[model samples]
Target: MASNKPALEGPVATVAPADNLPYGHGLGESGEAERSWGEWNPTEETVRPVRGRHRVAKQRGLARSSTVLGVGVIAAVGAGGIATAQDKPAVSISLPDVIADNLPDATSLPGMGSSSTAERDTASEVLAQAPLTSAGLTAADSEQGTTAGEALRARILQQAEQQQAEADATQKAATETAAAVEAASQAKKQQTAAEKEAAEAKAKAKAEAEAKAEAERLAKLAASYALPTSSYTITSTFGQAGSLWSSGQHTGLDFAAPTGTPVKAVHSGTVKSAGWSGSYGYRTVLELDDGTEIWYAHQSSMTVTAGQKVSTGDVIGRVGATGNVTGPHLHLEVHTAGGAGVDPMAWLNGKGINP
Candidate 1:
């Protein structure tokens, strides 16, 4: 008999002894017992039921547990060892239908034998080394698929660019506004200067016109007057200081000429006197329309009598050496309507005459 040693794997079964059986007759007494091996077949009535079904099930459970424990041990060994066995071909293990159906796959466990340990470790390292942020990526890394960190980085850059553009636009607008204000200010200043210049030109033109009109009026007045005598030289002017006058100063204009030189009326007037006075020889006094008086003294003759109407330039007297006279000269005097004597030279100049 074989030694009673344990089997490496499988379920063990137990059988019970049968009590009824056809015993083989001694040597020549074989009737129903003379059966060949080929003619014998098992029937339901020939075989008896075994009583160890529950025991077999229990043993199967134990065998399945042992298989699971063996697989765990193999996985542990593989994890600690080198992966030299990874190149070996896969092995197909066969199991009983009952065991196979109840067994869980090794890969389904927490840490099992799906791949080599070296391969798994290398994959973990690769995952750890991958960049987590786009900011740290190089140009080559940018070609890779976008991650969450890369997306966030792109959005931030875009927002910053937009804000910078807005700021530049605002600055440009402000510069344009300032330039426009400066232009307007310059225009206003130019307008003010132009207006002031125009006003000055207008005032100058008005002053010129007024001066021209005054000159024209004076020219018309000078036509109505004439000089008192002809062929004479002015010897003494009015307001002269000398001892020959009745007053302390000479108050008349003197015109020296040859004797019998004609003395004419200076303007249209009536002769008020045509006689010799105390110190005036052959004196003639003319009264104008405005009641002003003109005296012509030191005359050689009197051509007009008193109350005679004399026109301008009409002969009224002659030049002679008369009383209170130094030579043959005419002394002429003018008095205002209020009886005040004035300088004859100045009075003639006021009427547009030089002498």
Candidate 2:
């Protein structure tokens, strides 16, 4: 009989078993399967070469290549997962069926020396690149805040300087105004003082001039007049009340003296009358240059005739007891040009004589 076993280098072929074989063929009498078949007997047909063996080898080789490619993809993904886990926000990751003894320490990985050193290096790299992310945004905000604070400080300083300048200007203006006002007040006071001094000087000069003119007038009047008699006593004054006279008041001034005392002319004048009258025992009337009359009554005797010119101090009559007289006296009377009697004392004072 020919054997149906396929060769190792040939294509595999399907073989049908005999339908007549018992359920427990090639077993022992107890129907147990054989534990061992020591040797196989192959015929010539079992060892024959088969076709399409190269195609089968090629397929198997392609399947093995695909499996190796899948394993490489899985290793690449695991490395990416480790990096992703480090980059994510801190959290716990549980790996199933992974024992602590089977896992490698992160520091023992390739190109990683120690855990603290790697973490420090990673933090330095993150800080260096922080400007591109949210960390960078925080840094930018802080810088802006600092800039704003500096600007505000500068503005405040500028305002303070401006206010100080304005205050200085105001103070300077006030000082200038006060100085001007004080100067003006001083000038006004000096002007007023000068004016007052001038007024006082003018008043003093006017008073001196008036006194000089009065003295010159009195000297001129004194040179033109003289008293009527010397050594005579005034017994009665003009305008005296006396019942002895014909009028109720005496109209002449009386000078009492001894009989025959010489009476002189009071001024240069013409004699208007010199003769005895009823009440006047002896009388004389003298006419002055201005037509005023001077009467010498109660005279003892008359030395001048009517119409005779007499000089001042010339003897015109003698004093004696005359008309209605109690003793010897000279009664002198003055009359104006219109025949009005005047006080002889006042008339003598006007001529610059006291009596």
Candidate 3:
């Protein structure tokens, strides 16, 4: 410390004062700096704020324009990799180009951690790879820098993975359940429809069978009343021409009578079977008690429905030569309840009215 120290003046600054002071070098103010450091009468250019604050310059440190540009380029490249590579399509694009387009978003790269893990991870990796001027960055990048990035990237990736897995599981489950339910419902509907159709068919067949059986029964009964008009003459008795008959025996009794002779019923019964019977021409049958049957063949005409009931001696048909008979006549037969044939004459006699 000097003994005769002069009091400092002018703008106060923490910097040390210069030792060399020339006489008559200061401005009108005593002790003013010889060199004009600043002037209040500033030009338009000076009126504007300085290019930057010293504090801000200090913060930037040695981060030059070249360094910033390189960092931006690196960040852009990394970001482009993530953006361009997202859900790769049939075609591919350059990762570097995409990165360049996505540059100038440094803050977001680190902040993206709060968002999707995948995005955060990608942004963090890009951010870390960028030539940074942060306190964490090293001046000597020659020592290969670590792939240091924010934790947001990993978190984003993890979240993405978890969400994708959940979505896949949900989709799979829905597909399986839908298929199963559809199959089950289809089977149930098919079964129900099949059952209904089958039931209806069976019912129809049963009804038809019943109708046929009833017709046959009534026709047999009608035949009973159509016995030979007058036992005038038995032109041919059943079994007379054994080999000539289909059953190796005659199935009916033939009686000779004038053509157009009134045929009458032999017993009280209902008309059952009646129709053209080929060689027998027009024929009819009557059903009686205990399901017994009587047949009439070779008739000139039929005058009754299948289920008409008649008393003995009732006219049922007229004798004719419509069958394989040489003369006009009537043919008759009797059948047991089991369908086995019997002597019609005997069956009539048993009914108390001799044929």
What lDDT would each prediction earn against the true structure? 0.70, 0.69, 0.62
TM-score of each: 0.54, 0.50, 0.34
Per-residue alpha-carbon lDDT of model 3 for 60-144, expressed as tens digits?
A: 2112333443453354444452243233332332233433564555444444334557776888999776755434434453355
Off by over 4 Å in 2: 1-201
Candidate 1 TM-score to native: 0.54
Assess the local accuracy of residue 160 in candidate 2 as a C-alpha lDDT between 0 and 100: 100
| Pairwise lDDT winner, candidates 1 and 2 | 1
Which regions of candidate 1 fall more than 4 Å away from where they truly are? 1-200
Q: Give per-residue CA lDDT, model 1, range 1-355, as digits (tens).
A: 1122222121211211121122532113533323322112233443345444422121223343646534433553445321322444333333456555765665655445555466788888997787665665556546777664676687789899999999999999999999999999998999998888888888888888887876676566567778888888998888878787888788899888999898988889899989878788878989999999999998988878889998878888788987777889989999999999999888887777677
Please tell me which model should have the higher TM-score, number 2 or number 3. 2
lDDT of 2: 0.69
lDDT (tens digit, per residue) of candidate 2 on 123-226: 99987754433332345556665444445566689899999999999999999999999999999898888888888888878877886776677666666677
- How big is the positional error of residue 66 in model 2, measured in Å on the Cα after superposition? 24
Sorted on lDDT, best first, the list reads 1, 2, 3
Q: List the residue pairs that clash in candidate 1.
A: none
